[model samples]
Target: MDDNNSFQTLTDYSLQVFQLCRLLWGPIETPKNVQLINQAYFEDQQRRHLLSNWLHQCILSQPQQEQWIMQNCEFLSRGLLNDCVKFAHDEGDLRLAALVHAASGSNTVRDILRHCAHEDIVDVYSKDFRRTIAILSGEFIVKGHNLVDQNRTTYWQMALALHLWFANSASDSVSTIVRDFESAYQEHYWLEPIAHHGNTKALDLRWKLLKLYTDDTYPIDNVFDVNSYTQNPFDYRL
Candidate 1:
């Protein structure tokens, strides 16, 4: 098919899927409903495969446009799942972490934690460590680099430090932990850069989320580890 025809076909299919999602799962206001809608739409193996490829193409070729299309769609569950899966695999663990964070809620967090406590290598209650993962995930998403190109050394180091902080909370020496986190932020700034010229609004919103954690009182311990329980990594596309 020609580029125009392909685009048209994909657009039509995308719209159809969107409608089907609403019909099957109702309006997609919450993350649970989003997952339910996506699962229902992808019950057809053909759609599950085709939409996965289409969503990846949209993300790699025209991410901003893809985001626009997804936001405008009456149903976002499937599309969001597609986007998350595409980036999760193609973009690496960082993107997966971000998508998981975005999907979280009070109930989701508790459930994830219960599952993680039994299976994950790291302790779920380690607030500092969990918080670091969340922050790194957000940073990775905002930077928009290919997953392979991402410099995760600093992020990992911060995560380790946070884990130590949580593990040895009785010590009460948080200065080093704070410094480590700062170093991670600096590394993120230096390594993965984002253009804030045109998409100021989106950038602003991301910053707002980041700012919410700027204070010391933000409950880092509450950060949920979604990957801890599942044998496979979180792949929304599949």
Candidate 2:
């Protein structure tokens, strides 16, 4: 198939998925599970990544136009800003750090912390936007419905996934499909909440008595220990 045909096919399916995405994304219409929408977008991005590669496969030897793809891919690259900035600091690479900072989602508290040069927990809570601030900062604390909070899972899971994906560039594959997969993951990590559509997923209530972790499924255990969870968490292009 030609590039035009391939892009058409890709858009066609994206539009279909967009409908479902709108619903689970917890649009204001449902006004319930208002917090859990991020998890829904994360899962849907998984499907988008796979479909993206399939579209790419249809292009054959042609050089694909990346404008639309890049538009969607922005979510992934922006999501990595905190990790990228931290990576830059850890290695003391001034150039890399600057590049990461340039692309930061400025509204996020993490971006503010990255620029602030230190994590001031006191100032964070003192502010009216502490919850948004905390997740953006990637603080990873236990609060606000820990046991059954999909928002917490979404923020931390994407945080860990971003860190693990970019930690080792040497072993990361160079295939086109791999690129698409990573784009899917990175692009779905929106700093602001996705509003609109419809949803009602028990977001308001939390089970305080029972512990959330029956197993290691949703481990907020340690930021440093994420590497051991999977050799290659972003290797999902098959």
Candidate 3:
């Protein structure tokens, strides 16, 4: 364990980031008055909040820093930004959420995408992503596309990426997102869920909530489907 960054250190670093995010957005402890803070607007206003710079400046040693960077790359690329989008919608701050949403396409995701050789396919994903899914049972190009789980084809990821890319550019204001979110939502509403089944429900919930700012509106009372803001954030849970 001497060579590795202890879990505590990682936890501390994560807490630091969380505090910074909360300070920019709102205090998590007293959310009743957190209001609809725009983290994106305030974040940009901060002198320099570059994750790259933060990675280097932190107290973590080089290996630890490298590890953190790798982990964070995936977090921002797949999770954090998406959570921000969901929170923005839940808090009625679409404009700010839109900013983070815009940032999601940050180069890392694009870089990961380069590894895929097929442009026509992204990964295999079940279409429309229902929580209770049927085994591809029969859609195999003609029928069970016959697998319990499938990654979306490159074409699927490409189309999705493009749609989101355009959505980012078109984001104007909270009011605009009322319609704009739907444009993005149309792609999300029924798109296939990720291939892994381990946390299928949570993953599905996440996607639903991510586009939640879009038209994927869940009933405000249906806490099961979305907006569990009062709960611990993903970082803290880890």
Error of model 2, residue 116, in angstroms: 11
lDDT of model 2 at position 2: 71
Candidate 1 lDDT (Cα, 0 to 1): 0.33
The residue-by-residue lDDT of candidate 2 on 1-238, one tens digit each, is 5769756644653443344333323333323555665664454445434333332332232232353122212233234356556665676766545644653444353455434423455343423223333333443242322111224323222333333233222223223223432343345432221211113221110110011211134333332221222223362211
Higher-TM-score candidate of 1 and 2:
2
Off by over 4 Å in 1: 1-184, 189-238
* Prediction-by-prediction clash tally: 1, 5, 24
List ranges where model 3 is wrong by over 4 Å. 1-161, 167-190, 193-203, 211-217, 221-238
For residue 92, model 3's alpha carbon misses the true position, in angstroms, by: 49
Model 3, span 132-219: residue lDDT tens: 0121111112132311123332122222332333233333432242344344334443235332223333333323333343344555
Local distance difference test, each candidate: 0.33, 0.34, 0.33
lDDT score for candidate 2 against the true structure: 0.34
Candidate order by TM-score, highest to lowest?
A: 3, 2, 1
Task: Give the TM-score of each candidate.
Answer: 0.19, 0.21, 0.25
